[model samples]
Target: MRLKVIIPVVLISLSAGVLAFTKLGLSDDPPGRYEVIMNLVGQMLKEGHYQPKPIDDAFSKEAFNKYLRSLDVEKKFFLKSDIDRLAPLSTHIDDELKGAQLDCFRNINTIIKQRVAEASAIYPAILSQPFDFTKEESVVLDVDKVEFPADSVARYEAWRKMLKYRTLEKLTDLQETRDKSREDSVKNKTDQQLEAEARDKVKKVYDRYFERIKNRQDDNDRFSLYVNAITTTMDPHTDYFPPDEKRQFEEQMAGKFFGIGAGLKEEDGKIKVLSIITGSPSWKEGHLKVNDVIQKVAQGDKEAVDITGYPVEDAVKLIRGNKGTTVKLTVKSVDGTVKVISIVRDEIIQEETFAKSAVINGTHKIGYIYLPEFYSDFNDRNGARCAADVAKEVAKLKAEKVEGIILDLRFNGGGSLPEVVEMAGLFIPEGPVVQVRSRGGDAIVLRDRDKSVQYDGPLAIMVNEYSASASEILAAAMQDYKRAVIIGSQQTFGKGTVQRLFSLDDFYPVKDGQSLGALKLTQQKFYRANGGSTQLKGVSSDIVLPDPYYEVSERKDSDALAWDEIPKSNYEIWSNPVNTDNLKKNSEKRMANSAAFKLLNENLATLKKLEKQESYSLNLATYKAEQKVNTAALKRYDAVNDKVKELNITSMKVDLDKIGSDTTKIARNKDWLKARTKDIYLDEAVNVMNDLIAQTLPKMQRKQQ
Candidate 1:
C-alpha cells in the first residue's frame, strides 16, 4: 500500500445539487448527484491513473457490460429485451462519465429494480412445481457460458433451469445421506420424498436471497455499484469506496477485525473470500479458502442472512462480532461444493505477524525466516517495523551458525515501501532497490542509504502468487543483484501500481458534514531496478514451482496495467554470486523425479478441468457420476503435497525464552513451526540451499588456504 494524501484536489469539473466548480465559477444546474460523482471520479482517474485509458466507445462498452454483470452475475434477472432497450446507453457511457447525462446507470437502475420484482415472483413459482430429475437436461451456472433470456417466457425457463440445478444438487446430497445413514428418519425416505425436500430447501434459500436483494436495492446502493464499475474498469486495484467502506478504511478495520480473519471482496455482486490471514481463526480452521464464495452468514441458531448482492463492507459487518462469538458462513468452494463453516471471531495476534525464524538442521545448517507481511504501525515512530524485525531475525540466524538463510515471502501481500527498501539493503550493499514513476513524472529510484550488509550468506527467497508490491520489490531487487535464489510460483502477484484515496467531500461541501465518500485512485507504477515494470508481468522466479492457486494472479485479470520497461538503474551485482544455472538444473532434476511434484501437477490439471465445469446435469445419475469424478479429483488435490518428509525444524532458544510463560504465544509458535514442517516448497528450498552451500564451500576453503 502506498502513502495516501487526503488534501482537496481542485480538478477542472465538479458538480452535484451544489454549485459546479470549474475555471469559470458556479455553473448552472448540473445533472443530479449520480452524474456529479461519475464526473468527479472520471476527472480524478484521468488526472491520477498511471496509464489512464481514454473513456471512449471501447471503455464505455466495457464499463457498461461490467456494470450489468455486477448487477446480476447469474444472468437470472434481466431479459435480452431489457438489455436491448438499454443497449444504446452502452456507447453513451463515455458521455455519462464526462457529464453529458447518466442515462446508462439511471436507466439500468430503473430496469434492474423492475426485473428484481419480476425475479422475486419467478423463482418461487418455478419451485412450486416438482422438477423432473430423470430429464436429460443440464444447466450452466457460468454466466459467460449463457446469455440473457429473450423474453418473459425465456426468462422464466432460465429461472426454472437454475432452480432445477440447485434442486438436483440438494437431491444428490439427500440421497447420499439416505443411502449411508442407519437412522430411520433418513433411511426411510423415498426418492420422491427426497426430491420434494430438495425443492423445499432450494425455496428456503431463494426466499432469503430475494428478500435480501429487495432490502439492499436503494438508490445509494445502485449508484455505488455504478461508480465502482467505472473505477474498476480502469484497473482491478482502482476502486470507489462508498461512504460505509470509506468509514471502514478510515477506522482501519483490516488490522483489528473482531471476526473470522478472512478478507473478502465483492465480485460481480457475490462476496468471495480474498485472503485468509495466517494464524487467524479462518486459517487455523483450515476450511475457508482464497476463492470460496460466501453464500450466507448466520449467528448462533438464528436464521442465516443471504449476503449475495450485498457490498463487501456490509457482509464484513455481518461477519464481525465480539471476540469468541461464533459466525457460521455458508460458503461454496471453487469446486462447486457448498457447506457451512463455523468460525469464532478473534483479534489478530500481533506477534504472529512479526518476522520469525527457525533453525532447519540437515547436512548444511540452514535458517528459515517467515515474514507474513511487511507490517508497520504508522502512528507510532517506535512501533514494530518488518525491516527491523527481519534484521534481528537475520542476526539470530547468524548466531546459530547457519550456512544459509531462506526468507519465505510466499504469502506476503506487501506493506510499507520504506520497509522494503531497507529490507533489501540487509542482503546487499547500498543500492537502488526499486523504481517509482508517478503519472506524468520521470522514474525515481528509491535506494537504501546504509552501506552495511546484514547477512551476506547463501540466501534464498520463496514467493508465490500471493506475494505482491513491496514483496515483489524486495524479490526483484535480490534477483536483479543475483543476491538470492528465487523459488516458488511462476511469478509474484503483479500489483505494481500504487494507489491513494481522494476525498469527494474535499471537492464538494455537504450539509452537517455528511460524508461524500472517497475514490481510491491508482497514482503511480513500480519498476524493477533492471528497468522492467512489475506491472502485469510480475517478478518471474528463477525456479518455477507450479502453484495450484495460479489462477488468482494479476495476469488473469484483463484490466491490469501492461508490462513496460524504463532505463535500467546503475548498480553493481553481488561480487560473489552463486552459479544459478547449476542450481536451477539440480532443482529441476529433483522436481522432475519427485513423485509429489508429478502428482501435484496432475491434480492441478484435474482442478483446472473441474473449474471449467460450470454445466451440471439435471438427471440424478448423470449429475452424480460427474460429481463423483470432481469429488475424487478435489480429494486427491486436497492433500497432494501435504507433506514430503517432515524437516528437523526447531525454535531458537532466545525466541523460546521470549515466549516464556505465555501459553497463547507458545501455542501459536508451535502451530507456526508445525505448518512449515510438511511444506514441500520449504523442503525443496532447503535442498536448493544445500546446493548453494556446496557451491560456496569450495570457494570458502580456497579463501582460507
Candidate 2:
C-alpha cells in the first residue's frame, strides 16, 4: 500500500469550541489565551510553511464544546448515569482547556501529543497481535469495546488457524487433481474423455471438504472480526484492502484501482466472488465466477504464495499496482478444482453515485429520491452537495405535482452532518432538528431556521443495515417529528459518534527538523431531539420488513457503544390525516404474496442454519463427504437460477462465477442493490401513501359536499 504523505500543521485554535491561551500569568505582560493560540499558529506558519486561518475565541470555544459533548457516553449510548462520568483526569483536562489558562493549555497539548504518539506506535502492533481463540469463551468483557472484544479475538485466531489448514488442504487436493488429470490424459484418453476426466477430478477434489465447515458460526465470527479490525484504526472511511480477494469494497467506495474488475470477500473460510464490472477484463475473460475461493496469489515468476493470513491492505497492495500489470490468482472452483488465472489491472470509475429520480404511479404521484452519500470536493466551492442535490430532486418532483416523497438512505454510510440537517429542513417547518450535548452537559439544539417546508406533502424514509451516522440522525428526526414513516431492515448501523483528523506533524518542530505525522481522533456524539442518542442502538423502524440482516446480524451485534436516553425537549409532531395502521396492514398483505419475498425468506433460513455450526473435524473422509453435500446444494442453487431468470427481473441476473469471486459481497448484494433499484419496500411505502390519499380524499370530498 502506498501511503500518502501529508504536511502537518501545528495544533492551534481552529474552531469555536477549542480553548485559547497566552503566556502563563505573573509577568508584566500576562499573555491571554488568544495570544497563546497565535503563537502556535505563528510557529506552524514559520516552521511548516503552512498557512491556516486563525480561529477566534468564539469559534475555538464552540468547536471545543462540540468535541466534549461527543464524549458524554450516557448521552450517546444508553449507559447508566454512573457510566457517564469521565475519568477525573479527563475531566480536569477538559476544565483546564475550557478555561483557556496558559498553563492548562500547555498541559492539555502535552497530553494530546502523547496520545498521537501512542496511537501511531500502537497501529503497527495492533495489526500483528496474535489471534487467541480461547478468549471467545469469556463472558466478562463488554460487548461494546471498540478495540478488541474477547470473543472476536478468539474468533479471529480460530479463523486464522482454520484458514491456514484450509490452504494446505487445498494445495494437497490440487496436486491430487493434477496427478489424476495427467494419468487419465496418458491413458489413451480422447478430447471428450480428457474434458470429462478433468471435470470429474476437479469436482472430486473440491467435494472433499466443501461441506466440512460450510456456513460455520466460527467462520462468520472470524470474517466479521477481521473486517472490524481493519476498519477500527484510521478514520471510519479508510479500510484495509486484503491481498488476494474481494472487490466490493473498492467498487463501492474508491471507484476502481487495479486488477480484475471483480469484487471479492472471505465468507466462512472461503473466498467468495462478488461482482464483475460490466466492461472489465474479467467480464471479457468469462473464466472467473462469483463465489470462487482464491487459494493463492503470485507475482510474475514467483511461486504461488498462500495469502490466507495476510492483511487485506497488504493483499490489495500486491494485487493493485500500475495499471496494465498482470497478476496471477489461483482460484478454487465451487466444485473444488483449482485453476491459475491471470488478470490485467484497469481503472473502474463509479458513475452510480449520482442523483436519480423516479415517479411512482399513485393517486398522488410520489417522488422517489436516492442520495448515495454526502459527497463533495473539499477543494472546490461549487462541488456537489448530496443534500442540496436531494433538495433539488424533491423540488423537481413537487413541480411534477407529486403528493409524497421517499428518500432512500439504504446503504448510505453518512459523510457530512450539516448536510443532513439541511436536507431535513427541506421537508419540515423550521424547528430543532437535532440536539447535541457535550461532555460538560451543555446542550445545543440545532434548528431549521428556515420556516418553509420545501415539500411537506407525505414523506417516507427507507433505510437498512448499512445506513449510519448522518443517516441515523435524519431517520431519527423524521421519526421524532412524525414527518415520515421509517421503514426497512431491523435497524441501521449504529454509528452516531463524530471524529476529527489532526495532523501531528504540526504539534512540535520536526524532531530532526524533518518529517510530519498525522492522527484521527473520535471527538463528539450526535443525539436526536427528545434526548435519545443513536449510538449503538440505531433508530427502529416504524414498520419492519423481512431483510437478511434482520435474521443474521445487526448494527448492535458487533462491538458497539450502548444505547441511552437523555431529557426530552419540547417538540411538536407533524399533523397528517393518513392512517398508519391501515398502511402497515396493506404492506403486510402485499409482501406475503410476492414471490421474491418468499425466495428471500427461504434464503434467510438456509443462512441461519449455516450461521449455527460451531466445530469441524480435520479428518479427510468427513471433509470429502461435506464437499459432496455442498456440491449438491450448489447444483440446487443453480437449478433455481433458471427460475430467477424466468422472472425476467432486471436485477435477477445471476452469474455464479462472478458472484462467487467477489469478496465484498457486491454480487450477492444484489438483494440490497435490487432493494434499492426495484425497491419492494419503496413499492410498499408508495402503496401506504396511496391508501392514505384514498381515505383522506374521500373524507375531504364528503366535507366539501
Candidate 3:
C-alpha cells in the first residue's frame, strides 16, 4: 500500500497567488516594467522557498542555459533558432529577478507576446512542410539537448506552444487520412463528384481544427500559461490556480468532488469514462464502465448536443450541473455500440478516501490497514491526520491480538510528510526515519520522536506502482529498518522531491490589483539512508508479488524523472535481519501450489493480451469481434468469483454490504469474517510469520522451561 499526500491549502494559495500576479499593476513603460520585474525577481531569488536549490544569479544562469539548449532544432521538437534568439534575454531576466524589480514583468510580458506571435506565424509553415527523413542531413540535431530560460513565463509558454502545435498537427493529419479513406469508399463516383467530396471533407476538417484552436484561445489557456510560468520559477509542485479551477482542486485533495459521478478524459477525439466513482449513480446502475466513450450530453428533456472533439473543460461543463438535475449521456463502448445513460447530478461520496481495514484470517487475525491519504481540514488541527486514525486502529488490532500486520499502500500517492514520518514511527522505536538534502549541501535527519513502537510484531507493507512521495519515504524507512516485508507490484512511484508554494503577488504587480500568482517550487530531495534517491527509482519490494504491472509496465520505463544519486548518511537498522532469499522461495512455492494464485495469473495474462489492442473500426463485423474479446475477458473475471465459491472459502462471500461500515468493528467480530479465509496474500504472510515465530520462539521459551 503506497501512501497519497494531500495538499489542500496549497491549491487555494496557488490560485490566490495567480490572481495576484494577473492583477499586479507594474508600469505603462517598458523600463518601468523592467524595474518592477527586477524587484519581483530579486525578492524570489532572495526569499522564495524552493525544494531543489535556492534561486540565485548563478542558478538562474544555469537554468537559462539548459532552456536554450532544449530549443536546438536537432533536438526532438524545438528549433535551434528559437534558442539562439532566447539565450541572450536570459541575462536581463536574471538581473531583473536578482534585483526584485517590478519592471521585469512588463519586459517578460513583451518578450512572451513577441515570441508567441513569431511562433504562431511559423506554425502553419512548419505543419505544411514535408519532412524528408530519408535525407541524412535533414535530421540536424540530437534529441537529448537541454534548454533552460531565466524568464520562467517566456520559457514555459514557448514549450507549451511547441507541444500544442505538434499535437494539433498530428491530429490534423489523422483527420485528413480519415477523410481520404471516406472519399475513396464512395462507389461509382464521377471525377467531379470525387473532387467535390474531397473538398467538402477537407473543409470539415479545417472547420473542426479552427474551432479547437479558437476554444484553446479562451481563458483556460491563459490561466494554464500563467500557472505554468509561476511553476517554472519555483519548484514543479507549486502552481498558480485559476479561480474557476479552485473548487475542482479542493475536491481532488479532499478526495471528493461534485460532478456527474464519473471521471472523464479525451480519448480518440471523444470524452471517455475513465472510472465511475464506486458509490456514484452510474456505478450503482452498472451502465457506465471503463473505456466507454461519451458521444453526446443533454440536459433534462433537451435535445442532445454532439460533443465530439469538444474541449475537456467544455465537456465537463455540460456534464456537471446543480444537484437534482438530470443529465443524459450517449456512450459508445469498446464494442462500437452506442447506449444512452441518464443520471441525476448528486454529491459523490468517495469511500476509498476514508479509513478501511480488513482482517487477513479468522484465527491469526492479521490486521490490514489502508490509509488512502493524509487529509486533514485546514479548520481543524487534528482533522486529517490519517496516521493518528491508523494508530487508533492499531490499538484495536493489538487488543484483538493479531499475529502480524499488512499495511496496504497500493494506490497511495502521498499526502503530508509529517503524518508519514509519524506513521513510520508507529512501527519502529524512536530513530532517524529519513534524510533530506537541501541545495546548500545541508543534510537533515528527520527522526521519529516517539519513545515506543506501536506494533513491533511482524509487519508487511503492500504497495504498487501508484505509491509515491510520502508513501515512498515511509516504505524506504521500513525497508531500511528491516521492520516490514515490502510486497506487491514493482517499484513505487519515485517522486522524491519536496515542494513549497510562494505567492507571486508578493513580488510582481498585477494589472487588476486583486489577484495573486503562486508558484509550487521544488526545494529538496529525499533519500533513503542506504543511498538510493527515490526521485525516479522508487523503492523495490522485498518480496515481489505477482501483479499485472510486471508484464504490462515497469516503474523505470514510465515517463518520470531520471534517477540520480546523492550523498549517503549514517543510520541504524531497526529490525532483526531475516533471510530474504528464504522468504522469496517460500512465497514462490506457496503461490505455485495455490489454485487461487494460478487463477489470478491466468486472469492477468488475458488482461495483458487485451490491453495490447489499440485500433477499432466502425464496421459491424469488427465491432462484434471486439465485443467477443471483451465478453471473454469479462467471463474470465467472473470465473474468478465462481472459483472462489468452489474453494468453499466462507470468507469469499460476494455481499459487499455485509462488510461492516466500522472496519475496526469488523476486525473485532470474528463471526462476520469474509476476506481472511480466502485472502491468498494474508495466508502466505501468516505462514511466513508463523515459520519465523517457530524458529525464534523456542529459544526464549527454553529459558522459561
Best by lDDT: 1
User: Where does candidate 3 stray beyond 4 Å?
Assistant: 1-25, 28-217, 222-240, 244-351, 506-517, 550-571, 575-579, 594-705
Higher-scoring candidate on lDDT, 1 or 2:
1
Compared with the true structure, model 2 gives a TM-score of 0.53
Q: After the best TM-score superposition of candidate 2, give how far the Cα of residue 90 lies from its true spot, in angstroms.
A: 23
- Backbone clash tally for model 2? 71
TM-score of 1: 0.81
Candidate 3 per-residue lDDT, tens place, 337-419, comes to 99998888787755557555555554445666777766533324644457777897787677667677777787788766667
- Tens digits of per-residue lDDT for model 2 on 1-705? 111222342232222222212222223453442333234332322223111223334434433333332332112211232223222323332233233343323333343334333333332333233322223231212223322213434434433444433432453355456556646545454434434443444334333223221222132223322222322311243222222223333233333456677767755444557667777878887888888877677776678766553434444545665477777888888998989988877765443564556566535676777778755433235656667778777767777777777788888887666677888899778777877654334556777788888876777888888888888889999888877788887778777665443332333333344322222234456688879888777888877787666532234333234566777767777755345576778777877776656665666666566556544434445545656665565554444333332211221222234346564545435554454444455666666666666755666668669
Per-residue lDDT of candidate 1, residues 491-514 (tens digit): 888989766666677665444556
Superposed on all Cα atoms, the candidates' RMSDs to the truth, in angstroms, are 8.1, 14.7, 11.7
Off by over 4 Å in 2: 1-351, 361-364, 376-379, 510-517, 550-559, 577-579, 593-595, 617-682, 692-705
Worst 10 residues of 3 by lDDT: 1-10
- For model 1, the superposed segments whose C-alpha errors exceed 4 Å read 1-36, 215-217, 247-354, 379-384, 653-669
Give the lowest summed-lDDT range of ten residues in model 2: 73-82
Best-to-worst order by TM-score is: 1, 3, 2
